[model samples]
Target: MTKPSSTDRPNPLQVACSSCNLRELCLPVGFSGSELERLDGMVATRRSVKRGDALFRSGDAFEAVYAVRTGFFKTQVSSEDGRDQVTGFQMAGELLGLDGIVSDHHTCDAVALEDSQVCVIPYAELEALSREFGELQRQFHKIMSREIVRDQGVMLLLGSMRAEERLAAFLLNLTQRLQARGFSPTSLVLRMTREEIGTYLGLKLETVSRCFSRFQEDGVLEVKLKHIRILDLAALRKMVNSPC
Candidate 1:
């Protein structure tokens, strides 16, 4: 875990209707007036977590579903020796607790890589509101569908792709996801450590480090400690498609 930075302070209350970036992503499409108010009312609070902060642990009692307002995070599982293996990375506007929606116990641990803010919506309240409104139910279904698709994509990345390609694909996916949430797609501040990234991609820490060097050499990206900027996304796309 890295040391805390200045932007890692806790978040204040969030009213979705007032946030332009959240209008479409958090609220249902064409949601207006009273419907939006009902949706907004479900948000219990907004909280901030610094890099290296844990949102919840595996097997913890699940109380709320967090919708990321900004920044990135990872969902991880622990091995028998208590080492973490990252299962997924989440961009802004993505829901982080869907896997536990039915189980009521977290399926994995979620940790913020960057100083991030997430809207904590009580699951019970959301369920109650969703039951009464067909539109809300439809919207909830769509969100779940997206989450499922994203998970499938990750499975493909991890199960089939080569080491460097897996790493590149992960970066490309992260950029696009963040871009949808109104963040820069080309330049990003990495939140995950090299070791953490290796765990997520099923690569060795040294291989992950060498892959960064290869990217820099190939003019695909530049990495300096914490900051990463994708210099040639097209090149990266090609690398991700390259045969091992």
Candidate 2:
């Protein structure tokens, strides 16, 4: 795991959650004016992480949760045999470090896929604020619930889906997330390498490459290195929904 350098430290500049454009998509969603002010006060700093640097690694003390302001990140864990398994990918407007809430220590490493910015919300202050504000507590609970559901979805994908189905599902999910962030739904530049994708999907690197090649041959996608364009969105969806 890459150690965080001095440059990765949180900047002292105050983050204004109320005025941040990502408010609707982040923790401040649906907050009243006064509530937003409280949140803005709680989120005191913004941190920048350069590509390939870890924001936090396994067993690190967890002081706060970070809300992604820009760029992407992947959460991974090292296996006993020294293999790293990609657990999940996070993008703008998503929260990281939630995995630490239970034990007060991170269980996985969060590495930036590109230069990224994040708003730091101190967990202690956030907890206090949530206790005082019912709406905030509800929103926080909802976010946690969403994470649980996502984990379950990943389990289903890995446990039952075929190689082609897993790849198609991954692309569809990635495009949908990008579309939610106002990017084109059918086209994307992959931030993680194919090997990383295979790690997350529980497939071999060679299998991942062959799956992409097959998709290209079937006119389901146009792939150029890291860039991918979905030529047959319906076909891809059918692959995911097709019988096991």
Candidate 3:
């Protein structure tokens, strides 16, 4: 018997909403069994992206939304002055390209942080389907509302929070998200670079490094390269809540 080629290998991570554990955390929440089946049909194809590849570049034509099936991504925007800012990081089960729905063009670039797969859900078809399914319409509204709230939180972090407070809050937020996906709350890998973290937190790269070292000295967390271990989550929480 001939061995199968690499192209013929099956992907263990390629799964639809009906079989995905992340369904509860994604657009499929509150969807009935039949509704989930219908959603599966909307996902016409899954596209694989390599690390550092742009899933969709800024100002790209937006035809569909993507659901992360595996791996992580970072969305960023470039300023008029050529400075790029990290807007947000997306993980498995999250939706991307929603920023394009209103303007018909992507406002930010979505780059894969690792080899990833995303289910392509055509925006036009989704809109037509939502018109027929009230549950889906409501769920989509909730998803967009949640994104707004998340953006507001980022604003709060950058506008008023101190450097340490921002970092602590960021760690807590990451831990919460990973925990939701059945991952370890105290340990995880950072997909983005330190400079990216500093960019998102509105801090200098040196300051971000210093803050991490300070946290380690304070027993709040242990950071080695991109890996982080939460040594004292309560302490980190206290730092986030404490006034500067």
* Of 2 and 3, the candidate ranking higher by TM-score: 2
Off by over 4 Å in 2: 1-14
Per-candidate RMSD, Å = 3.9, 2.5, 3.8
Off by over 4 Å in 3: 1-15
> Cα deviation of 238 in candidate 2 (Å)?
0.5
Question: What C-alpha lDDT does candidate 2 achieve relative to the native structure?
Answer: 0.92
lDDT of 1 by residue, 1-244 (tens): 4866443444454555445366677745678777877777787477777778888888988888888877789999888898778988877667888778778899899988887888877889888998999898888899889778877987888888888898899888878867876679998877778988899888988999999999888888888976889999988888777765
Clashing pairs in 2: none
Number of backbone clashes in candidate 2: 0
- Encode model 3's per-residue lDDT on 73-138: one tens digit a residue: 999999999998899999988999999998999999999999887887899989998999999999
Between prediction 1 and prediction 3, the one with superior TM-score is 3
Worst 10 residues of 1 by lDDT: 5-14
Q: What's the ranking of the predictions by TM-score, best on top? A: 2, 3, 1
The lDDT for every candidate, in the order shown, is 0.80, 0.92, 0.88
Q: Write the per-residue lDDT of candidate 2 for residues 165-210, one digit (tens) a residue.
A: 9999999999999998889999999999889999999999899999
Compare candidates 1 and 3 on lDDT and give the better one.
3
